[model samples]
Target: MTSALPDVARHEASDIALALDWVGMRGIAIPLVLGGPEAAPAAATAELAVDLPDPHAKGIHMSRLYRLLGAFAQHGKLSPGSLQRLLREMMESHTDCGSRAARIGLEFHLLQQRPALRTPGLAGWKSYPVSVQAMHRDGITQVELAVRIQYSSTCPCSAALSRQAVRNAFAEHFGDAPGITRGDALDWISGHASLATPHSQRSEAEIRIRLSPAADTLPLLAMIDCAEMALATPVQTAVKRADEQAFAQLNGANLMYVEDAARRLRQALEQHFGACSVAVSHHESLHPHDAVASCATPGWKRMG
Candidate 1:
């Protein structure tokens, strides 16, 4: 009875006789779990495709690819090894149709609980956007991982201008009053320190790195932590009055332009990963446009 079913995909020849680069599914929703101490199931969107190298073939078997993805969703732990295995399986499943290459992409958010800057026992969940890509071509497999980290960037120029304004205010108030005491200065600052305020905006850094073939597990949390530490001004999730004050202090201490941010991230990530690409964007609060900077190590090939 099974043999009576139509197998047109395997039996028929293509009318167009044109080879295609890729043919398969996209926007497939699947459950994925990463390998780590805190790993748990997370929802991910996946794209699975294989190259249609044979111009004479009618079409590749779509059901085989879907079933394999379904099986991975059920029991697979996402890692460089696992993704490579999945891509190999994808290519094998299409050998009858002459597929020579395959690739899989996964996009998801990794949530982490972060503590407040100065508040004890206060924390909140922060979500970071992450993506993983694995490609098998010409008997070689390459895997890449990328993550986006949100931070706060205070404009260095704005900070300097604001400081000058405060200094001018202080001189004006004290130029005529020669007998001013420390208490008087403190009181004046308390009353008018914010006469001019530095402009700060939320910024984001995207780091993409090629995974080493010997890598066994995804390094999502480690990379996130390293990037955040390098930036030194990650946006706070849970903030009390004290935490807000601490955040303000951090912004004032680490005033940076977009170039500064890109350099900081690129230098740190390069040290950690040997080579990496970093792109940073500051959503400008002072203007109608954003300020952006990017840098990559030599010979870095970004995944598409």
Candidate 2:
């Protein structure tokens, strides 16, 4: 008979005797099916990992995990039902290897068709950054979904200051003529009031929410709607003069600071989703650095 192959993985001892919390793979190429069978799945990358609780076990079945993931990605639809099954299978595959936990992260872009403001035509596609993570550990199964929303943010303080400047300019222009004609005053203010405008910049809201036990599917579009509705300044698609005016009016009506943006998103998520974390960042045109704010609700469980 031929010489037996040396199974070092099962027979060899480690130089150090210690247990690791997690070990496996990250940034693996995987296609994600973010919807039901009716919707086509999208390509995505994943970080699949498991715990090494047994210090003596040479290694877990890495190939088994990969094959299982391959099957899941190929046939299974990516929703609450499919993700829970995938995580359980992963944990079961490593049961004999002394792994008590397993985790996977899928990152991908979800294309959304946005409607033009005050127009019958539809806007082009807008891709929102979306990530879903599932972890089965110590008998606790948790699933989380994260989405990034982009919009415009106008500075509340800057808006007030600009209004004050306009008032001063109007006072100076009419100081000599208290009895200035209504037409003359209206024309003067029309040209001068807009002279000092507040600075606004692009902003983003990143929200992560854990699914409730009752949830059967990931409410991706609903989550986006909640965030955009609360902020009331989502970036538009197709541009028209009327749409531009509407956008300007929105910014003016919803002047806020970075902290305000964070709280608005957090409050909306808290009221609707219940368990969530939100972070908002304003890329300031007035300053070189960006402004940021964040909050987490009580139901949120921090994941690694």
Best by lDDT: 1
Q: Which regions of candidate 2 deviate over 4 angstroms?
A: 1-7, 36-38
Itemize residue pairs with steric clashes in candidate 1. none
Q: Report the CA-based lDDT of candidate 2 relative to the real structure.
A: 0.85
Taking the tens digit of each residue's C-alpha lDDT, what string does model 1 give over 40-141?
888899998999989999988888999999998898888898888889899999888889999889999998899999889999999999988889999999
What digit string (tens of lDDT, one per residue) describes model 2 on residues 1-304? 3248776656776677678887777777887666632265777888887888888777766777899889988887788767778878888888877788888888988888888777678576788998888888878788889999999999999999999999899888778766789899889987887989999998998999988533567789889999999999999988788888989999999999999998899899989988789988999999999999988986566777
Measured against the true structure, the TM-scores of the candidates, in listed sequence, are 0.96, 0.93
Model 2 steric clash pairs: none
> Which portions of model 1 show Cα errors greater than 4 Å?
none
Summing lDDT over every window of 10 consecutive residues in candidate 2, give the lowest-scoring window: 32-41
Say what the RMSD of model 1 is.
1.4
Root-mean-square deviation (CA) per prediction: 1.4, 2.3
The whole-model lDDT of each prediction reads 0.90, 0.85
